[model samples]
Target: MITIGELGEKIVATWLEPQNYQILHHRWHCRWGEIDLIALDNHNSELVFMEVKTRKPQNWDQNGLEALNINKQKRIYTTAQIFLSKNPLWQNYNCRFDLILLTYIIRKNNSNQGLIKILNSNQIMYENYIFTIKNHLKNVL
Candidate 1:
């Protein structure tokens, strides 16, 4: 079974696909850390390194924002540098760090009457959870 975090990453990738973003890598790792998603903007010739966070509404950490502390950012930065060193083609492209935040909302309504009304463009209703894209912070790091 796919973990919640992984599922969130997949959802983010799917969302980006329609916007002309080509996914270069997923879960790229090194000694420092792992990057959840790496994508290239076909329109602007930019490379994006994304960190995806998935969480429930009632939890702490500002829905995973607080979890990305200074130390974690540094590790991700170092890992990005390592990735650049290995991938020479993408090295020349403009690079940026982005954060994708997703929230998992439990379905409270049994009837389908309000389901269509509740969902917006950035939300998806899965089995028993509604995954919503809470925020997309570009050039975060």
Candidate 2:
């Protein structure tokens, strides 16, 4: 099963596609840490290193951007540097760090109203759940 964080990344990628961003990598990891998404803006020839934070609607005390502290920023920058060093072709592109915050509302349907049954096992049908993105923030750092 796909985790909520992974699902959020997909939603963010989908949101970025129409805006001319081509995803180069997702979950790129190095000794420093992992970059949530690495994308190139075809329209402006800029490299984007993104940090994605996914939170359920009721779990947030602050905006996701605020969660990226100085230490996290340092780690992300170091990782980006490593990425640029390993990929010389992209070294010339202007790079920027961005933060994407996704807030999802997950609804469990116990009633049959507006619920789609996907499977039937022992005469028990699985109700469809909905995941909705409530907010997205970009270029926070």
Candidate 3:
């Protein structure tokens, strides 16, 4: 079975494909770390580095911005530089770094809350489950 990270990357790629992005790489590992998704916007001639996170109610990474920490940002930036070096012709194009957060809310009493995005990480109280976006605290040890 694929892990959550792997599945998250796939979902993100699928989400971006119809949006007109050419996915160049996913889970590109480097000395720094893994870049979730690297895409090329043909129409805009820009490169986009995206970080994706998915979570169940109890495991949600809130705001999803936590997925891109300072170190992760640096790694993505450095990796983009390396990629740029290999294709100098595209160096002049714009570069963007973004993030996507996926989370689900659940309740035993009510099953219709699945479409709502949980706003608070620690304060929500559901009948059976609560969704919370958490800060990214992955230690690169």
Candidate 4:
């Protein structure tokens, strides 16, 4: 079963693909940590390391922003360095760190709610609470 976090990443990837970002890796892991998405921006020829935060509308930590503290930032930075080292081909590309925030909300009234059911079909979901892209902060780090 795909976890909610993984599903959120997939949704972000799906949205990014149509906008000229080619997903190079998903859930890229290393000793330090993992990168939710590694994408290449065709428009600018840049390498992007994206961190996704999915949460219900009502929660502490400012919808997961607080979770990316200095410690977490260090881990992600180190992981990105490792990735670039292993893939020398992208070493010359300008790199950036991005943040994607997803909020769980119901479609009927567009209110924050808990996720109920999800389907793996191309349609994304059947209708309860869905993760919506709340923000796309580029070059966050």
Q: Write down the TM-score for model 3.
A: 0.64
Q: Of the candidates numbered 2 and 4, which has the greater lDDT value?
A: 4
By lDDT: ranked, best first: 1, 4, 2, 3
lDDT of 1 by residue, 96-115 (tens): 99998889877775465423
| Per-model TM values vs. the true structure | 0.86, 0.77, 0.64, 0.83
Q: Candidate 1 has which clashing residue pairs, if any?
A: none
TM-score of 1: 0.86
- C-alpha RMSD for every candidate: 3.8, 7.7, 8.0, 5.6
Per-model lDDT: 0.85, 0.72, 0.62, 0.82
Lowest-sum lDDT 10-residue window in model 1:
109-118
Give candidate 3's total backbone clashes. 4
Tens-place lDDT per residue, model 2, 63-128, is 465679999999999999999999999999989888876665545655655433322211112233
Tell me the lDDT of model 2 at 106.
Answer: 47
Clashes of each: 0, 0, 4, 0
Error of 1 at 86 (Å): 0.6
RMSD of 2: 7.7
- Backbone clash tally (model 1): 0
Candidate 3 residues 18-41, lDDT tens each? 568999888876665667887887
